[model samples]
Structures are given as structure tokens and as C-alpha cells.
Target: MAFREYKIGTRMFGIALGGSMMITLYMPSLTIYSVGVTETGLVKGLSYGHNSGFSYEDPFLQGKGKPLTVTIKKDPVTGADIDPVDAYVYVPGTPFPSAVRNPGILGTEVAALSADDGQVGVATSDEGAVFLVSRGDYEGETFPYIENASATRDWTAAAVLASAADTDKRHVGSGKTMFVREGCEVSYAAS
Candidate 1:
């Protein structure tokens, strides 16, 4: 007599063929069956057994759009506990292509990270927006996050105040006089 094993998913079963008898067994929780065979290889046995096992849906093939969230955080001092600040966020108006508004979405907003403490959160809205942040000496730079959807240039100021509340940390000079080389205008919402 010889035995063969077959596996499907996590279950295994065995089949045995003898001179005139055929036995089938399911394992781990073995169930046995006996049958009589003719010379022609035809076997008489129970037609249907237990079920073919459980059916499962493919997990990777489903879902669409699926909302996303992102958060960004920073700390100037290593150990001292400091409240997280809300950075700037802005999205430009839709652009016109050949004098027509394209069918894309755009938006921008600034929010603090959740209490759980994380870096950045990217959320999906029906609208798409470019998020921008200003830091160090480049604080004055300002431009729409999504500049007309197509323009990659960011219009920014030449200097930024490291700490707006402290005069000593100003990015331009050491308690020094400076020139305002032409005036520039920027529109942004402060948190």
C-alpha cells in the first residue's frame, strides 16, 4: 500500500491505495473513509465529503480613494518641553489651461499634530493643496503652496525672524540697521 498527501490552504489530507481497497483520511483531525475498487480503477465511496473548506476574499484587491492623514513637528531645544506650533498652509487657486479650469482639486491648511506626537499628517480631501513651511533665516519667503497648479516658483521674502517675539533673534542683523529693498506683499493666515 502507498500513501500520498495533498494540501490546500492550511489543511492536509491523505489518500491510500491498496490491492482492492482505497482509504482517504483528513489529518490534524483525522477522518477516515473506506472504499472498494474494481479492476478498471473505478472506486465506490461516499460521493461528497465535508465542505471544500472556508472561502476568503482577497484583501489587497479592495478599496479606493481611502482617506490619508499627515502631521509634521519640530523642536528647537532638545530636552525642554515646548508646545507644538501650527505651521503655515496654503493652496493656490485652480489654474486655467488654454483659458479653462482643469478638473483637479487643491487646498491647504495648517494644524498642530495630534496629542499622540508625530511629525506630519497627509490627509486626502476632494481638493489637493501644496503645504509650505518657513524656518531659520528664510522665514520671510511666502508663496502660495500650489502656485496656479503649474508654476513651481515660490515667491518668498529674503529674511525671516527666528523668533518674532525676541528682537535678539532677528534673522537680518545684530541690533543693526537694514534697508528695505523695495516692498513685497504676502497673504497668509496666522495660527
Candidate 2:
């Protein structure tokens, strides 16, 4: 019996070859395939869109203490309608505020608008602005919002609809909870 020895990470293993005139073999690394967590302790397999507005702690405005309000407009009396579904607000150095729950006053309907014909106001303690985005607008269909020193974004419409379609889904257990928690609402175009 002919024996072939291989060294893997300071350990040696032997393989027996029997009656092999010509054969091809492939050896892959023994590292476990990662599905979620990365070496840097961050979640993997997630993508984000672009930054649409003023970012917190922006280099241009350093040490300028001022609370900024971000409004998502649904209609434009003078120009064009603004879709609230295509907007996201990012507050750097702070966690994204949970979407206020209500019937229509201020909830995560994704259709809520401010008193103005086209605006959803978002109050920020820090200097930041709202980011306007659309489905599949940037590299990925996800919107990347930086908050609490971490980067997060809204899930695409496909993901949201899929989550809502599931019957056994619950509010807390549902994947679309982020949409509700983030006060995401939809806005319709005025006809």
C-alpha cells in the first residue's frame, strides 16, 4: 500500500493510495463557512444605499451644535410629488429612533406626511439631514443609514412584502419590525 502524507495546520495526516494509475483530487481548507457574523464582529450578507442628505458630524460642519429636522415630502404643490417610501433619515452617533406607533397621526405607515403637502418631519438632536432614496437606487436595494456607530439601512420592498406575506409572522417576530420601529410610512402622489 502506498501512503501519501499531508500536513494541515501543524498536524500530519496520511492517505492510502491503492491501485491508482491516474487520479485527480481536490482539497479544500477546513475553515467553517460563515453565514452571519464576520471576523470584525459585524453581521455579514447586508448591503446599504447612499447618504442622501446632511450627515451627523460631517467634516464640513464640525462643532456646530444645532438640531436639524428632516422632512419627507409626499406631494409638491409647485413642482413634483416626493415619495416618502423612498426616503430614510440617518443620525450618526445615535441609534435610529423607533418608528412612532399610531393610527395616522404619526405611525410607520410609510404614507404619513407633515402638515405641508409634501413633508414628514424628522427631528434630530445632532446635526444631520434626511436621505432620499429609491428602490434599487444605489449599488444595492438597501439604504445604508449610519447610527450609533453602526451602519444600517432599510430592507428592499421585496423583502418587506415577503415578510408581510408570511401568515405565521408576528409583529415582534416579523422581519418588517424595523419598518414599523423606524416610523417608515408611504406617501401617495396627489392626483
Candidate 3:
């Protein structure tokens, strides 16, 4: 329910989601694909050891997988994009951000609920922390445990193993845990 500026060594022991949360992503360099035509977008490979890289799998899509088509939003609330072809997170609907262990929304949960409104600040390149996902209520989401880690640091053996475990339980349709982390992103997508 609170937003903190992600720094290296920021403790993300348990967030709403147990995988990578969205970090601040610049729209121009990033690329994101929309899910089901306008519902939401997923970042590829965001699960670190689990997802396909910056992209995350949507648990509600009948099966587990991320979006396949690139999308950009023109709505001012989502932000303005110089290039229409790019999946720009700064623009509110862009995608393909830097892959980290437990990806957290780029900023506060409210920003996340609406989309990464760049509340923290704009990035020249992909920057910030990856909030770890845990199966507890974090701003109202649930799943695995992903630690907020440094962008440059490599994942520890334990972290990687933990991520794999979370991925397994998270993608299941019944619980729909991934939504804990993705709830806001999906909400923004719907807008």
C-alpha cells in the first residue's frame, strides 16, 4: 500500500507477487505486448529465472503466457509516446523492461494500480529494484517470494531456486496469484 524508491539492497522479502515487479522503464527503449487486445500488458522475462525475460505470463489467459503483440497507448493518462511501435512503460502501456528477479511496479502501488506513472522519476535506461513476491498481502496481491535486488547483481542460487518454486505455484489458474503483482498493470491495461 506504500511506494518506496527502489535502491540496491532494498529488502523485498515478500511483496504482493512472488516474481519480478515492474521497475521504472523508459517507453522509447522498452517494448511491451498487450494481453487479449486491451486488458493489460505483461513484461517479458520479468520472472527472472521463471518467465521468458522481462515478460511475465498472465494467469488469466486460459493458459500461462505473456502477450505476443506489441502495443502502445495514446491516452495522456498513460503518457505520450514519441514512437507508436514501441511498448513504452513510461508511456504507461509500454513493455519489455529490464529483467530482474522479483519485479515490482516502477513506483508506488497506486502508480502500479494505474500503471507505472513514473512516480519515482524517468530513467535513461532501465533502472531500479525488483520487489520479491511472497504469498502474502502486499498492497493486495499474492504469490511467491522475490527479493528486491540490485539491477547489476546476479541472482543467488537460493533466489533462483525460490523463483522457480514461486513460478510453479503462481501460474496456476485456480489461485490466480500473479494478479497480486499484476493487478494494477492489468487495471491500467483496461483503461
The model with the greatest lDDT is: 3
**TM-score comparison, 1 vs 2, better candidate:** 2
Task: List model 1 lDDT by residue over 3-113, tens digit each.
Answer: 654355225232223312332223311221122111111100000001111212212311111111111132222223345332221212211111012111111111111
Give the Cα error of residue 127 in candidate 2, in Å: 2.6
Once fitted onto the true fold, the runs of candidate 1 whose alpha carbons sit more than 4 angstroms away are 1-63, 75-143, 147-191
TM-scores, in order shown? 0.14, 0.20, 0.19
Q: Candidate 3: worst 10 consecutive residues by lDDT?
A: 33-42
- Give the alpha carbon lDDT tens digit for every residue of 22-135 in model 3: 343434224432111111222333321232323344434432332111232232223444243212122112232333211243223323432232221222223323232212
For candidate 3, the TM-score is 0.19
Per residue, candidate 2 scores C-alpha lDDT tens digits across 64-173 of: 22111223232212233444332232333322222211113222122222212112243332433333322121233232221211112232222332332223221220
Model 3: per-residue Cα lDDT at residue 91 = 16
Model with the higher lDDT, candidate 1 or 2: 2
Global lDDT for candidate 2? Answer: 0.25
Instruction: Indicate whether candidate 1 or candidate 3 has the larger TM-score.
Output: 3
The alpha-carbon deviation from the true structure for residue 92 of candidate 1, after best TM-score superposition, in angstroms, is 23
Candidate order (lDDT)? 3, 2, 1
Locate the minimum summed-lDDT window of 10 residues in model 2: 42-51
